[model samples]
Target: MEEIERIVSGKKGKIDVTPIATIFRNEIKEEVTKGQMKPRIVAFLTTDDAGAIEYAKWTKIACNRDGIEFILKKIERLDLEDAIIDANNDDEVHGIMVYYPVFGGMLDAYLQDVVSPAKDVEGMSTTNRFNLYHNIRFLDEKQTKKCVIPCTPLAMVKIIDHLGIYDKSLPMGEHLKGKNVTIVNRSEIVGRPLAAMLANDGAFVYSVDISGVICFQAGKRQGTIKMTETTVTRDEAIQKSDILILGVPSPKFKIDESLIPEGAVVINFAGCLNVEESVESKTILVPTIGKVTIAMLERNLLRLYQNQMQSRSTSSSSSSAQIDQPQQ
Candidate 1:
């Protein structure tokens, strides 16, 4: 694939993802503009956070520009579950997304599960997550329909691939086999899923969280994830890592600059970047990906829309085949 990356030229520099994002937007626009009607995504925001609100606004703008329908529904937290069910059952809605931190904890997890898999564009639904962690890439026995992946982590994968870290000549699951990675955040939304994704793709991953650092690696079995609890310290993990992906929401939770090693690939998904500005010079730094993340959201919506179309076509064919068969 051609490089779509933008460079920041100065004493301190990092990778600007605007061009990569533009490539994704152009592809999605081309993918949807051919059809008479467009796929629709319903996003529910039950939080009052400024960031979430702004994200919703941009999501609408991106979707509109890509020829996809976008709806932002600000509703009561209590009614959010019921509203998701309604959207799930609604035929016109091709995809669903929920802005986070609403009811933060187990309740938010429950809300994630409420969105049906077919309409889950964010790929946060239990079924999609389960499939992702298990390294299951398809939705059907025939493998005709593909499964959805969470937008942020998928964007991370794409960015890493664009950087040429993943060798295309290698087998699918063996691309990152020799690399050691460290992921700082362990949130269900991004970190944990990302750790599993890399581990599944054959990286030895050090998953760091508030609790401790755990080692994630590909399982002995063909399609499984192996998690091993470790006493590895954050700095230790950072020192040995080939790639470091960080995401932490708090402004006070910045990563120590001295911890980053030379010649490492650094990717940050935090709204408030967790790494120091100077680290940009020492590493292959990806400071932010606001547009690229939005692009992944649009891509997921298109994939789910395709899945829906395939399901309809299959059902219609089955019905016609039954009608054309001899009466029994």
Candidate 2:
């Protein structure tokens, strides 16, 4: 850790995300207020983890400000699955979020699968995960509606764009085609998904976990992703990365600061500090993503609401056409 201290002991810089989040928040607020949209979202908190509670609180506050009907429902871990199903069955609820670490491990994954795909605002369901990894843009075979993305990864990508890293002049699939990136967490929710998202966008990615490093990159075919074990050491990957991401949940775990290259972009989404304070001097540190997460959460809800509206309109139009047809 001392080595980390030595590397980042000087100047400091960080991306002020308030403006970016505000842009999203105001857009949401204006759309809802102007359109009179009452998109309802219910977030279930089944754990007493302070971080989860605080996140849920932020989610509710953001929703309220955006003029959406929001509820923070507290329930026991044992009943979370059933409660999610109830919310899924309720026509009034447009979106749903679950505070995680309830049961931890595969059980939590099972709970993720239980949430209805249409209402899973966080986009943590199995189907969404499949769509993300496979680069499927739409929820249906017709390809009319777009798929929902996990908020955190989307926020991170936004950060890169906001910071001027993404060359907008470049086409979509090639926006990040030239960058070498490193992400230091491999958890199912955040790390794994993020790596795939980056790879899908054409970045060469090094995904680091306790076991080892996995290489991720766009495949030879368009919209395809590939991952394989790599001989590149963590330090080597960090040294070469244009973008560095950290999401370790515990303070006990941290990047040895010495590994971070000077002027590299580093982003942290974890509640605890995953990198030393000094590293800010040597890197472009995106220290928090909570606000953007909230914005993305509401954004996903609006998308689902819009899809529902479109579906309703299409249904109505078809019904009218059928009724107007001459008797045959």
Candidate 3:
């Protein structure tokens, strides 16, 4: 087999995500300083989940480095919703994130629904979900008017854009035109949202699930997505795809090394051994979820602060105009 070039590791070596993360942090710190606001993020975590605990540790480190206060509240399965609600109502909490597998995923929906959309930094609220699905475009160049996007999908797109997969001169939705992309999972959090996003970006997207293959077409407003039952196997999809996304959360779901053609970009969202080691050199392995999540949290915090500032400025300008008006 011929040697495949690694996307993340190039001529200079493995791309340093640390510097990219630092840039995000510095920009956020500057925004917080200019706005004279203390930004804080509250994470509601399960008491016993080892993964959640480890994730929280990295989150704290990132928050500390960026000058944002990180608060971790341990809650039982029953009190999860209440904790999220409290975080939403707290004036100091600019962002709220809940670690998953809470009560073995039984309370995921309840916790997600209870968090206020304004504070839902993880983009789990119904409002954000609707906006993402509908391809709603916010006119504000600052993106303060749009809803928060899920970090994993956001990070994936950013990496791909950085790799010049998208035309830099054009808008995001026009970037992947003529590209054939395949996503190998359909979960709500990662796979489904990612498919919608990529489809909106004009890629010919094939979302594979046990049920069938769902084809997506980019529309002017609300894009069209159609699902059809098919007998196509995973290997068949991989063989024909230009870009392959794997989100299957199982070790047994490893891909056949021979199936991945040379120059195909592979992204693994599931933090497990789902892909073969040989693919690593040819793939862009997403950094740990915690790192990307922290970067996104900083972004959300800046947007929230900027929106608040803009609102205040608009209100103050209106008041001044009223004072200057002639009495009639």
Candidate 4:
């Protein structure tokens, strides 16, 4: 852990992440009026898993440091109904997130209940999803944002955006946009949401299923930019892409020097636990910890905080107006 942190610290000069998160946070705080207002509450809905707890802690710190109040909803040995009700009734809680996955179809039902549309920071609410599909998902007219973009997908895009230098020599949206970028697994949190997010960004994304097409699309989209959920090392997959995003730490797939295109920019969002075979020295390898995890959590918290501020300002103004009206 120390070595990893040191490695990340060394790269700080090259990639400054502080400003990136600050910019995002300020964007959220901007929507509110400057004055006395009700305190904003955010709930960190999570499970007993250590990772989830750690993530919740990160979120709590970020929120508190920014003057946002937060609460934790841990579903350790608790029934889903009780958990959902507890989350819903917490008036101080402006957002709800479910960090743990439940067994059977019960998880879906619980998610729907725990996350109210207005407070769905992670955008898992059925109503918010409905609004998303209908194209009406935004707090303001010109905002042009989704109600809640999945954290991982948002993290991936932010990293890409921060990188700035996309090889534009290969055309813009149409070339990479909507091209069949294949995802290996189909988890709702990652694959489904990622596919939707990427597609919304104008990329033709395909969440790989057993029956999906395997033939590469000749030119660009056919064989470019593969972002995988799990490890699947196909020589054709490696030889054919311009950008590769790896999101899993499983040992199933390993990239060899021969597999990747020369000078390919690879993003290992899978964290440092799984390192593929070293390619040429020119291969640009990006680690996920400092890049994706923190960035994504920071971004989501910022968005959620912004939405909370907006809601508070509106509520305060409405209350003031009502109070000003003479009693009947």
Better of 2 and 3 by lDDT: 2
TM-score of 1: 0.90
CA displacement after TM-score superposition, residue 246 of candidate 3 (Å): 1.6
Best by lDDT: 1
Comparing 2 and 4 by TM-score, which wins?
Answer: 2
What's the true lDDT of residue 304 in model 3? 54
* lDDT (Cα) of model 4: 0.50
Clash count of each predicted structure: 0, 2, 0, 3
lDDT per residue, candidate 2, 1-328, as tens digits? 2333333343247655777788888999999988889899998897677877777777788889889888989899888878888887676788888887788889988888788766778988877877888777776555655678898998888767767677668887778978999999987678989998888777999999878999998888777888898899988999899888988878897888898888888889888778887787788787888888889889999997876666566665311110111111
Residue-level lDDT of model 3, residues 176-260, one tens digit each, is 8888788888877778788888877878778887777877657665454444445666678778887788777777878786787
Candidate 2 has a TM-score of 0.89
Model 2: pairs clashing at backbone N, Cα or C within 3 Å? 4-258, 11-281
Q: Which ten residues in a row have the lowest lDDT in candidate 3?
A: 318-327
Error of 2 at 165 (Å): 0.1
TM-score of each: 0.90, 0.89, 0.82, 0.65
